[model samples]
Target chain A: MSFKKVVVFPAKLENLAAIDALIKSTAELAGLDARSIYAIRVATEEACSNIIRHAYQGIEDGTIECGCYSNMDSFTLVFRDSGHVFDLTGVPSPDLDSCLEDRKAGGLGVYFIKQLMDEVSFEHIPGTGNVLTLVKYLTPDSEKSST
Target chain B: MEYIVEKLKHCDLLSISGRIDSQSAPELSEALDKIMESGQHKIVLDMSEIEFISSAGLRILINAQKKCKQQLVAGELVLAAVPERVHEALDMAGFLPLFTIEDELTHAVGNI
Candidate 1:
């Protein structure tokens, strides 16, 4: 079996649902269960929202391209955006032990994306832009797991 | 996202339904703000219908929680009926321990 799909759309918060729906449909067709489908959708939303709000700084209207593919072992999602390159080093994971007054929700998006997917990677090109890839391994040793 | 505000005996209950993303997050903020302004310190967010929540939404929840905490003697915001997906999302974001969450609406309202 072979499966691959791609889409390009404007980078706007209004388009988030559409992006999620597109990926959710592809994930469903790939035979993911409800939990996996929801994880993909949420992770995709966090990534795209970051682009729209931070990468683009909610200022410049940009474009984002997304792609999805299903291999025998895992499901993969890709995001390509021409917005400003993200600086991962500058962001800190929120201190979960911090007092309520000290705790911040700033970096939760990246954190959630990392938690939901098995593997996540990012790259920045001088002339192009940032490319983010997220993958979720299908249940090991089996394409479907009832658990 | 869509919300319906009900006047429970002890608090202002807002049952929010739909995706609370960047676009719709402010609406929830506004609703909470208006409630706070009206001198209603206790708020119950019935999230049984919220299917998706992004970081943006979580930010609003944290801010609201902090603000309501100041009035803890008289006002607070609690969560009830959180769906499994939403629970997992919050847990993943390290937010499960941040708020007073209950399994049922009556329990949440009673706590506040």
Candidate 2:
């Protein structure tokens, strides 16, 4: 079976709770285990936070639409925002192996979103908006172990 | 998120609960900054009650750990009683090697 839940909120840090709740309930309904659910939650949070912090920076009244789509095969999240052109692909990876003082922290959020999700795609439409989609595949073994 | 800071004999203990996402990460950073500003570098972070931590939280932890290690006093930050889910998040971020982790708060405070 498949289902979807979506929420639209102003692209502000304060509204992250509502965004987190949306993803949590969707992941629970998909019968994900504690770890997978946490992964999805963190990935989606990172996506939304990036949108708010970077995409909507200096823009007024910007909004983000998050959709949680789940099925027997996979769980997917789609984020849409009408802010500036912020390409996550262009962001460089953080130097994880570097010493603490030499390491940088700026790109971890995008890196985490890519690391946690199974498949991710970003598309931008001219004068429309940017759509970022994250997917996590579901396995029967995973579903059974959670129960 | 909520935090309680306790000044122990060898190190300061900061107990944090609730989600540490982008919004609340600033608060965590502030709390750690205050502890370091007081010339105390050794810290034991009690994360037994933390339900979730995002990359934002991880950034704060790494930055604080760096400061604790590189500061003139040269102290370390120890994570204590980390929940399983939170531990996995740290592991996924490749952060497990950055700090010493203990299974109990008493052990973290005692060792640090």
Candidate 3:
């Protein structure tokens, strides 16, 4: 069985809770583990926060479209925004070896998104906007086996 | 997310329950600020009730740790009863070895 759903919300911090709840519910319906659900939620929040901070430049007036899909064994979350296009490809990876005092403040969100998800990809369509796709495989305990 | 701050004898204890993401991190930061302003340098953050934590939450913890370290004359900030999920996030983020973390709150408070 396959399930897919989408939602569009304003690019504001206030709407983040609703988005998080939606993703959590979707993950549950998909039969994902708590860790998998947490990963998805974190990645989605990073993408949404990026839009709110960089895309809208803190305007809080733009819109964010979130699309989620899941089957028996895996889940996917896609975030689309029609705002200032960001070059996610240019994001620098965090140096895990660096000490806490030497590490910079920002950039850890993208790093966590990269580390938690099984796969992460970004697409920027000039006229359309930015699309961030994240996927995670459900663990054995969370996946429904086919008889 | 919910956070409760309690005043200990020599340190302040902040207990965080629920998810700590970008949206709820500000509340934690504000609580940290209030504790710092109260001239409490020693702190024990009990994170056993936290189910999930993101990088934004990690950033706040790092900031709080740094603040406590700056104000500490002898020791560092203490984190107590951090759940496995939060521990993994902190470990992956290379922050596990930086702060003094205890598996029990009583041990942490007693050590501080």
Q: Report lDDT (CA) for all predictions.
A: 0.84, 0.88, 0.82
Residue A88, candidate 3: alpha-carbon lDDT: 63
List TM-scores for all candidates, in order: 0.92, 0.94, 0.91
- Tens digits of per-residue lDDT, candidate 3, A44-74, equal 7887888888888846468999998998668
Tell me model 2's lDDT, rounded to 2 decimals.
Answer: 0.88
Model 1 scores a TM of 0.92
**Model 3: per-residue Cα lDDT over B1-112, one tens digit each:** 8989989888888898987877888998898889888888788899989977878888888887787777647435688998876787788788877888899999999889
* Candidates arranged by DockQ, highest first: 2, 1, 3
Weakest 10 consecutive residues of candidate 3 chain B by summed lDDT:
B68-77
**How many clashing residue pairs are found in candidate 2?**
0
In candidate 3, stretches whose alpha carbon ends up further than 4 angstroms from where it belongs are A139-147
Off by over 4 Å in 2: A141-147
Instruction: List, residue by residue over A1-147, the lDDT tens digit for candidate 2.
Output: 499888899999999988999898889998776777888898888999989988899997999999989898889999999999888967878877876777777788888887777788999998999999998878846442243
- Top-scoring candidate (TM-score): 2
lDDT of 1 by residue, B10-81 (tens): 999999999998878999999999888888878999999998888888889888888888884746789899
- Please report the candidate that would top lDDT against the real structure: 2
Output the worst ten-in-a-row residue range by lDDT, candidate 2 chain A: A138-147
For candidate 1, the per-residue lDDT at A25 reads: 90
lDDT of 2 by residue, B30-74 (tens): 999999999999999999999889989999999999989997768
